[model samples]
Target: MEISLILNNELVWDKEFKSCKEYVSNLKSLAPNEVKMREMEAKFLNLVNTDKDVSKYYKIGGALCISLLTNTTFAYADTLGGVSDKLKTIVSPLIELLAGLGYPVTYGMLITGFIMVIMGKKSKGIDIIKWACIGYVGLQFVPFILNILELIGRELRNSL
Candidate 1:
């Protein structure tokens, strides 16, 4: 009888076997380390799955990286071995929209500070300094609000 097992969307095993138990026992005898490694992997996966904050960070980080790559005109799709063009396009626009909302203000302040220093406006640079400080402080709030809104938008889009 032939049995098959798929892992990570790949056909990892497909062969004739007398019995599942025998196959397992043979695997255990032949590759004890493999079994132990698989068990450890499963435990780690379970831990990640149970941790809501960790999962959220993973999702957000992945989305942010993809967005950053797309916005910066990098070949993110090709790098990932050609992920769907639609997904690449979607991430690019979402990143642009988020940036358009207010992100540029933060960068603008930093640029202004640099320009003020270069223009020999040592005393007037205080204003740019203050703006940079405010922008840094505002960053803490911006990410939280944007994350919440992104979540809501994703939910609404999925619902539709």
Candidate 2:
């Protein structure tokens, strides 16, 4: 289970190869494809599974994973409240700019597109209309998308 435990083991080094010269010639008193090799492997696995140190190793690993998840959960627990407030403060100017400049431009595009269509520029008008629709939806629907994400976060936090 641990490096020190295996390094201190004498039989392992004795049975294992030392170098190229010893590897080709030495067999550690055991023939190639010995009958008991499979049984030895199975028993070694069984021993490892039942070992006290191995249990401790698994317990430590599980504890570390749980600790990490718990810490991360706590770290992001206020994502929809405290973090959101700070993020809102940081992004307020951008939101204000979008509201102040984006809607009027989109509305102008829509009206221009309508006029262009009536004047026989169908393709250009359609493209302008499409872009105006996209802009309008981005301005209006983005908050709903954000709310959905906040709801999902709240559910996960509650379940945890």
Using lDDT, give the best candidate's number.
2
Q: How far out, in Å, is residue 86 in model 2?
A: 1.6
lDDT of 2 at 43: 84
- Tens-digit lDDT track of model 2 for 115-154: 9999999999999999899988887877788889988987
> Any runs in candidate 1 off by more than 4 Å, and if so which?
1-123
User: In candidate 1, which residue pairs clash?
Assistant: none
Backbone Cα, N, C clashes tallied per candidate: 0, 0
Off by over 4 Å in 2: 1-81
Task: Give the C-alpha miss distance for residue 109 in model 2, angstroms.
Answer: 1.4
| lDDT for position 122 in model 1 | 69
| TM-score of structure candidate 2 | 0.41
Worst 10 residues of 1 by lDDT: 73-82
Residues 6-115, candidate 1: write the lDDT tens digits: 99999998988678898888888885587889999898778779999878887778788988888754344352213534665669788667656555676777678778
